[model samples]
Target: MSARLEAINITCRDHAASGARWAEILGLEPEGDITSANDFITYRIPGTEVYFAFQPPDNGEVGDTFVPRIHLDAVASGNTREQELENLLTRGMKLVVDARTADGAGWFTVEDVDGTQICVGRSDEERAAAKAAREGSS
Candidate 1:
């Protein structure tokens, strides 16, 4: 057997709001709650089978309270690098890091509804190349 990155799950305070943000940023659509308990939600990548799941914060802390931390790195589509970061900022996302260099690096760190950290950043060329590959495959 082999282990693989199936999905990245984070805990959120508001399911609907977080899900909506993810949908807009990642250009994804949610089908339904990931589980019957209605605590987890999934957003599917357009041209891939991978998924990102957001759940509720963990309870039953015995000692130090754990702050939820997770991130879903999605391809930036049809948007400038700065535009992507700014869009999320307008939607209540706080910046963690910002850089636009020729080397195609840097990332923005933002917290979810539950204070969990997520880094969103990638170059336009990278995204466009991925889009082209996806289009070619499809």
Candidate 2:
């Protein structure tokens, strides 16, 4: 049997805030009503079947040392990678990693308001070119 991934569930202290942050970051809107603070909120990334759902933590206690096991990686669309990084920073996301190659193909990791790490990079073509250069050098 094969398992098909459909949605990603995120637990946060404030589901509404987290959902809003994700929506703004992805340029998506919440799927349903987000008025209720106790209710979970979901957002579907454009051009993707996957959904991201945010809910309050079950334990009701915010863990100061909790680190997410998985981080999300995204490719910049409709803008240059530098612009995308600037946009994210302007939105109060903390820059964790900033790396670039000679060809200017690189990625940056930013921590969102909810402390979720998201890595944004250039498009596929730039990635392919960087990979080819690396392989050729090797």
Candidate 3:
């Protein structure tokens, strides 16, 4: 059996606010309540079958707490190279890693309001070339 990605759980200092930010970024409407005994809220990216959930930080002082590292990577559609970067920036994303090169290659790594790192990339020509190569091999 193979493992599949279904949901990602993120611990945020402010779970509700983090949920709202992720909902806006993913063009989704969040559901659930952090105060409803569950202490978490979820945002689902429809048609993609993926869910992002925001939960309260671990119970303890920072020095005694364990925070898990969480990062996600995604591919953007339409345009090439910097279009996803522009869209993310317009939506108030903070740039973390400037992976773009002078030769017009590479991708980007950005952070959300809750400091969740997400790497996004778009390259039509490169993808097409790779697809063609794969098809040729097939």
The best candidate in terms of lDDT: 2
* Model 3, position 66: C-alpha lDDT score: 54
> Per-residue CA lDDT of candidate 1, range 1-138, in tens?
111233577666655567778879989867665345366788876777667787766663324565555765543445655666777677787776555456565655666566655555555576566578779999
- Write one digit per residue (lDDT tens) for candidate 2, span 1-138: 111234566777777888898889888657777777575787887788667878776666678854333356677666667777788888899998887676777777889877777777786556677799899999
Model 3 ranges off by over 4 Å: 1-66, 129-138
Candidate 1 achieves a global lDDT of 0.62
For model 3, how does the per-residue alpha-carbon lDDT over 12-128 read when each residue is reduced to its tens digit? 666677778878887975555544625778777777766787777778323446575566656565555477777778888899998877645567888889988777655555567
RMSD (CA, Å), each prediction: 11.3, 11.6, 10.6
My TM-score estimates for the predictions, one after another, are: 0.41, 0.44, 0.44
Query: What lDDT is reached at residue 125 by model 1?
Result: 72
lDDT of 3: 0.67
Candidate 1: pairs in clash: none
- Between 1 and 2, whose lDDT is larger? 2
Output the better candidate (1/2) by TM-score.
Answer: 2
